[model samples]
Target: MKINKFLLGAFALSVGFASCSNEEPIKGDNGGATDGEKYVTVRINSVGDIGSRAATDNDDFEGPAEGSSEGNVTKENIRFYFFTADGMPFVMSQTGVNGTVNTNMVKPDALNVSNTNGDEKTSLEAVLVLGAPEKYVGNRPAIMFCVANATDEAAFEQFAKKRLDAIPDIEVNTPGEWSKFRMTSSTYKEGEGEGAKVIYYTDISDNVKDTKDAAMANPANIYLERLAAKMRVKGLGEYTVMEKNEDGTLATAQYKIRDENGTTITALKVNLLGWEPYMTANSCYAVKNIDKTWTNTSLFNGWNNADLHRCYWALAPGIVSPNNNTIPLYDNNKFKYGNYDGNKPTENIVYTYENTSYQPASVTDRSTKATAILVKAVVKLEGSDEGIDMVEWGSDYFTLEYFKAIVVEAYNADKDVTNQATAKDVVLKKNTGADARSNTWYATVKGDDFKRFSNISWWQNGITSYFVNVEHLGSKYGVVRNHIYDYTFNNVVGLGVPGDDPVNPQDPKPSYLAARVHVLNWHVVSNSTILQ
Candidate 1:
């Protein structure tokens, strides 16, 4: 059921979703400032998180009883919001529209997530500021939600305010459940859809019980989940930065994605359609359906093989593109969603760019395995999306929903999905001549070979070109630590992987961290240039 058409209170069924947001109300967590308020430390993607690891390509967990785990979450740009019993301000309803958003309800500073570690203090959160007892309107409870960036925040509010009863619609058919998420990778720098929504509820009766019910000043904790995947490209060629030189020169080049400001991006959209992430038959609730009467726990369980195939063969639970809904799914497959029996496959949706005139491209299950993440990059200069390269990486399942592994064992050693160690479909890019993978095999004096690797570039060639899998790209030989390197330099120098590997394997000076590139310049090579 599209969240836009639904009522409120749909999130409990694990259906309604919203984008991330923030403005200013309380300041005691990450930012500087505090009003001596008791802050609720909410952790996102904690252990046993709803989105967890699976068999292959982070595929759904198995068994008769569908269960879930706390999967890892890496935020690039995130924002969240909290509303009191009082419904969200109508002004804050529709973002980037006729009215303005109530920034006061949001954090003064947005959560600028580069690599958000859900377990660490970095992911800590609290309400902006304890809302006025009057502000905490309703007698029921308050709401908490997270979205990708600013655009999503506006869209969510706009829809919520329109509902007549209980604004910010928390009812079963509320707009929250109807909220559309960007399930696929981002095609442009601005990002694709409003992204996904992760929301929860916290009782605030103590804060808004009676007119005199005050003194309940505290920041609440809120956990968020990404309904949509995140993917972007780096603007430099395929070179991993191994280390920085004494004179400030790059010893080796590696693939580390950066933003317009040249900041090292630790994570990208791994997978929006994550493993066992509330899918088919369980994706949501059908308030109007007379057949299967479902509940919250029973629905948002996980994905099963039967449902997986059904999702793949379906048209979609929602629209493919948020902006442009034309060019419907050609698969002509249909399934059930809510009360409808001909519901389209939600996973089959596409992630295209407005720059491409909303022309849908191959970011689908039929075309490639790495359907989850799209590496968006500005290859020309800095601060410009002129030459954006939207490249795909990951396996075919769940579109292999976003891969966020650094130095991960990404080889399909068994060659197929058999013993599924690392994404079973992920093949080792066969490097030739100097950069061959077999060279990384090291035989110690003990007659034992320990395969070591550096932050090397692993390319994934698609309709776009050869894009690097930064997560698995490591060095074959290295004690060289993590160092920042400039991509535009003529000498793409890495620490140990010298300018010339023919004579001696170039290794850089020692350091605590391994190689890393602060900035990136990507080159999406044509099919002819593919190494493998």
Candidate 2:
């Protein structure tokens, strides 16, 4: 039994390629090519054309090595799907050992190929022996789709089992069915615990040739893409950090915003809690698809270079709200806290399916809202103790105790000598007929009816949040697969949304957070927003 060997190279860069350990012999009665069969060599490329976009502030996380059996781009198994020249599905006859071979796939022998030119490295290859009926020899398969790490028919919506003994067929020409095929966890059976697998697939319709000799000489190239995007939060430089002591031990953490000269703001402080993905999509198509009417196409200036398999925008499931709204305290899967070290980026990163909003007219529009990072933090005023919680009213911020004193003074000014009130007499105004949720602080004197007066209780617990919408290359706002979003907070000025609500969080009124976002190759994209 002889195994044909070839080479599969990494993407445009010298990384993210998968290699097989040993060649599995092609098992069949006919050891080699039969009368109607041909040999087609394919060089699968792992993630191609991640652009040369530079990071403005922080570096991206390192991708996994090709030889390693882990990471996002690793290919444990690969399968091929064929379509005739006329767009008809081509089903291969089950050859090899009956129970061992799937008609749609062939396990290739792994051979590492090193490029002498140093343009690329750690290549993988697979040689396929394609058999066809003698009658259809001249008009064999013309289009090929390569998929990696999708072995289980029970796992993917694209490979959902319709009957036993064989995988169901797909309508190659049916755009609706093809676009609906996804690699996601939403299709798993109840309690299957079979989380969504990181699957990669590519279309090589343009690479196929008419004859076997032509294909052998010019092996078809496939650039596999994972149907998800990655994001990381990093902080650049150091800050004037202030530690709050409780019982003579440091209990709370805070940082003072400084000017360009490193002069600290002594009156105000901020305590960064963590960040979570807002409006993140749970699923993406196995093969990315784009809308023909995507007018923001101009924004993809250096994007969608097929030669390098790099794309900037993709159509993803639209999400109006966050899947989870629980305010995370410590570190968890959904939320990650930044432990600043004044040297490197904090270990705050996440992976999510592409989430896009088509040419959103305004950021506040819920129907076309883009995916964002919800950064949670506590804004406080420097005090004798740890810090003092503040409340927002009208146009200014007042400490909780100070705001209470103003409310008590207002009540006394509105009353006679016998009707004067104190701090304990003030309470939140109650909602009544036709009135919305009372956003006012009310005065309830000894026997006087409660009177609604001023704004208060907006900043509950002194916690605030800011939403930083992820952006693509050009004019649009979105997250695309195989790209990295690195966001670093340079400085947080003023106060953000009072009482940060994970869902429906409002933009900061007077203050804002200055942050820089870099998306890497994972084509890296850089976005800088200065909040005032």
Candidate No. with top TM-score: 2
- For each candidate, what TM-score against the reference? 0.28, 0.66
lDDT (C-alpha, whole model) for all candidates: 0.23, 0.46
For model 2, how does the per-residue alpha-carbon lDDT over 185-215 read when each residue is reduced to its tens digit? 1111111124412112333444444454555
Model 1 stretches with alpha carbons more than 4 Å out: 1-31, 36-40, 46-105, 110-121, 124-127, 134-141, 152-221, 227-301, 304-532
lDDT of 1 by residue, 454-487 (tens): 2232212111111111121121100000101111
lDDT of 1: 0.23
Model 1 lowest lDDT segment of ten: 476-485
